[model samples]
Target chain A: MAKRTPLYEAHVAAGAKIVDFAGWDMPINYGSQIEEHHKVRKDCGMFDVSHMRAVDVTGKDAQPFLRKLFANDVGKLTIPGKALYSCMLKEDGGVIDDLIAYYFAPERYRVVVNAGTADKDLAWMRQQAASFDVTIADRPELAMIAIQGPNAREHFWTAFPAGRARTVLLQPFQAVEWDGWLVARTGYTGEDGFEITLPAAQAMAVWNKLKDAGVAPIGLGARDTLRLEAGMNLYGLDMDESQNPLESGLGWTIDLKDPKRDFIGRQALAALQPARQFVGLVLLDRGVLRSHQKVFAPQGEGETTSGSFSPTSNKSIALARLPVGVELGDTVEVEIRDKRLQAKVVKPTFARNGKAMI
Target chain B: MSIPAKLKYTATHEWAAKNAAGTITVGITDHAQEALGDIVFLELPEAGRQVKAGQECAVVESVKAASDIYAPIAGEIVEANTPAVDAPESVNKDAYGTWLFKIKPSNPSEYDGLLDAAAYEKVAAEH
Candidate 1:
């Protein structure tokens, strides 16, 4: 049997279709996935993302330990409650996992990793902490809830009035603690909202309160579509341990400016020359674009990493890894079964903050 | 669960009903649509195409994955439902009412050989 989240009973009560996702029995959809996608685009929707693990790193050497582990510079996070998106890599520049690290103080930091990679991430963190003076504590007792959309903040504030003061003042990519709950302005969906981490025992009550406040219960299916449209990469689908950040459209996250800071993957990344380019494609035809489909460009053949029909754009969009010679505005052919359909290369972002960015 | 007694069904979850004109209308079953979740797109065979029994003739793509809609019996495609093709979600709304294609069977006995509602329900339940 798959592991169940704290809100599993609530999901069953809402008539959700449950599926096994990364060993967790999660809701794929309540009813229409298209409607759920649009609900997040137009109104407010809440997702139970408790399956993702949050690990707390503390002690005197927390900063230095994370500095050596992450490709992105955690030393840049000077302000408390500021979060940084970084890829934790191995010694050979291969990405182990991409995570969001929130800096609370010099000795205290919290990192949230992907659900599928949680156990591996914790093991890696423990293995790396042998020489450092840091304690890595996995907080499985916490349940995470992501409330997202244009009116998401308002709905969240309505549900939990106690968090209104701090949640209202939260900046993008920032988090605040309120009454033992960590409410963050960061979200996977391209919307203004909060990813609140609270006691797992209290998850059902909060979910019910949000539902009563008119926040629609969204599932993992809509979450995938929303993140894809926002140009966010899913961990295993977009990149893995064999892939590096430079060729995975995550070059901006890597901080190589400081000469003295020698991270785990720094030497490998510095000596390597990236040969592939990651880009976005908008299908010019009627059919949908899917992952692992062959992409034929003027430069060379590549494959789509993630693809789906965007409800906001009313067209199919994809994130593809192509040859470095392929440029923007160029039309590429994607092999969809028997036909090679045409798609236009463009910027990866299709929508953000309830607005179309393409 | 809404299997029509007059219609025939395949183990692959396609339903076929004989019309007054002697041609048979084909569509995915209610159970199939429920399993598929949301129908995003449908790729139907051309009107004049010839098909063999159990041959994969059409494609139905849902949010989850793409599924092949196989031909229930040997037949020639007479008409493809353009409306259903344009709005694929109608299949989810009413699977029986939303016909995918009409076929003029080469041998009418093959259509009769298909499982009826009761037998098809048993097969669907096992799945």
Candidate 2:
């Protein structure tokens, strides 16, 4: 049987197309995926992202334990409520998952991981934290809602007037606790937004309140397109245990500068020279770019990590991992079906925060 | 839902209408277009391409995914829909009105194998 989130019934009531995603019954769309995509880009939209796992790590040893576990240095999060985006890597420098760690104190941190990789991430965290006196618990009792787009924050504040605390005034990548809720001014969409995590039993009320406030309820369909347009990496398609973070456009998140911090993947990462670099590709011609498509450069071969039609660009674009020698402005060909279509390599980010950044 | 009683449909969802010129004007069913969602690009067969029954002849790409448009009967393509290709979203707006292509079947009796509007509706409903 497929797992169901707290908002499964709500999605069904909204006439959403339900599909089994990562062992969970989730909404693909309410009616039209295109319309949903436009709504988020043009106005305020909300998503029931409750299926994503939120694991809290608490103990006196949490700081040192996370610094040793993650490829990125968690020591940088000195201020409470500040968040750090990092990739959890295997001992051999393979990417296990990309996640956001929110620091509440020296001994307390909360990390949100992808739903599909939740089980594996939890097990790995537990195994590593066993000797550090840190407690890792998956908060299934909590539900997460991501309200995104330019008007997302304003609409969320309007939904619960009393719920908006001084923490709601927090800057981006910051989390604040208020009224039994953890409202993080962070989101996956390349838009101004907030991801609110609250008790599951109170989720329906919050969703309804937001709906009454005229926030458009979006689904997985628009979420994928939005993230792609923003140039954010989707965990499974962009990188996996089979690939290293350095090759998947996540090298910036890895902190090799901290010589004192010996993370799990430190030695492997230091020993291996980066053979390939991830670059963004904007299809100059017709045809949608898709994952697993072979990218051909004059100098070397490459493969598309995440590719799709950008709703903002109205053209196909992708993130391709290519030979480290390739630079921006170089041309390449992507094999789409029987034809090899021409593409141009651009800088990493193509769009962000509901606007084109390229 | 817009299946005309006078038209016949293939299991693959292409609808065929017997044109006055002894050729059949074909388009995908409304159900098929809706399933595909917001058509972006369409590749129709050339006017002279020979097609076999159940053969993949055309390609329709939507924002979500791509699908193949199959030939309903053994026929020679007489006319291709150039207007529909230029404005593919018209298929989503009015699928029955925007014909894909015209085919001259070698045997008219092959039309007997096609499903009528009522039968096609039942097939679509099953999905």
**Whole-model Cα lDDT of every candidate shown, in order:** 0.92, 0.87
lDDT of 2 by residue, A1-358 (tens): 9988888899999988788889999998887777888788788899999999999999999999999999888899887899989999999999999999999999999999999999999999998888898888889889999999888888887987775666556899998886778898898888888899999999998999999999978989789888888889999999999899888988899998878899998899889898899999999877778888999887788999888777777777898999988889988999987789999999867777666665
Clashing residue pairs for model 1? none
Q: Each candidate: how many clashes? A: 0, 1
Per-prediction TM-score, please? 0.98, 0.96
Q: TM-score of B chain for each model?
A: 0.98, 0.96
The candidate that achieves the highest lDDT relative to the unseen native structure? 1
I-RMSD for candidate 2? 1.6
Off by over 4 Å in 1: none
